[model samples]
Target: MGYNGPLNNAKYLKACFTKPYKFFIHSVVHTVSHRKGGCDVMKDYQICMVTALVLNKKYNFSIIVFHYMKENITSKSRILVYLRFV
Candidate 1:
């Protein structure tokens, strides 16, 4: 949810420098979390929450973060855009 330091700075940096792996961790984690959803209920919740946190950090876009990033964007506009994209 918040800006924590890299999970594995070395690996992350390597991923950033390498091809196809710039977003490798995020992609793999997302797939794994989605697959886990069908197996265990509590684990699924944990995976979903963690995945949301990872995505929030990687994209730097979440409701809370978005307000901090663009103070000028109105909540109504934000909701409208989100709905439209969905």
Candidate 2:
């Protein structure tokens, strides 16, 4: 069954990732939720992931790109720091 409701709703999230998508979805959700904040983090992550999934489905975008970009920004900042020290 496909879900078309608000992702922040635990019921929808639970229903949406029942079979094949369960492990991957749960891992991503847990990783994102814990990495971002403490309270209400899961809800925030649900909204973000829903937007990302929708955009991915509609525009053929890769969510991995967001991960890459985040890493890239961190690496760039580290490089800048190294340059400043040199």
Candidate 3:
């Protein structure tokens, strides 16, 4: 987890973990929504896993490392953090 702040209503669950010297990370993203229908205030959760050259390197580059889908492992988080994966 890098940052945490939400003194009142909801303190989101943000986390980040990595293996030393590894060029990858695992994180969970949560979306908070408020709607006319209270029941529709539910959220959508997604998992994000990425690998890239973000360290001390000559050049910087990032590419889709993996995608996780409930039905197919061939897919990963897209709707929320699609830009990061690209």
Candidate 4:
């Protein structure tokens, strides 16, 4: 994704400054979309790696978002994953 406007007018960027999940989903969506190349099936993306360290210590929700990703996009034998909770 390239810049849409001038740096001085980066209101959209500033607006998303506090949203990390959006960025994570954005990057993963791009990578998986690129790898899938127009496929909608979860089993189509066989060579993509998507991992997340979900930490919500305040609510005791420190989980590795692996099963969620797998449930969303199932992979083949080439899917590499290394997820952990800290």
Candidate whose lDDT is highest: 2
Give the Cα-based TM-score of candidate 2 against the true structure: 0.33
Name model 2 segments beyond 4 Å from true: 4-12, 35-44, 50-54, 57-86
lDDT-better candidate, 3 vs 4: 4
Candidate lDDT scores, in order, read: 0.36, 0.45, 0.26, 0.35
TM-score of each: 0.19, 0.33, 0.16, 0.22
lDDT preference between candidates 1 and 3, better one: 1
List model 3 lDDT by residue over 54-82, tens digit each. 33334222222222222233336333322
| Candidate 4 lDDT over residue span 2-84, tens digit each | 33334444123322323654565455444434233432222212112322223322321223144545543566655544332
The prediction achieving the highest TM-score against the true structure is 2
Clash count (model 4, backbone only): 0
User: In model 3, where do residues sit more than 4 Å from their true spots?
Assistant: 1-18, 21-24, 27-55, 62-81
Models ranked on lDDT: 2, 1, 4, 3
Whole-model lDDT, candidate 2? 0.45
**Cα miss at 67, model 2 (Å)?**
17
Question: Which lDDT value does model 3 have at 22?
Answer: 24
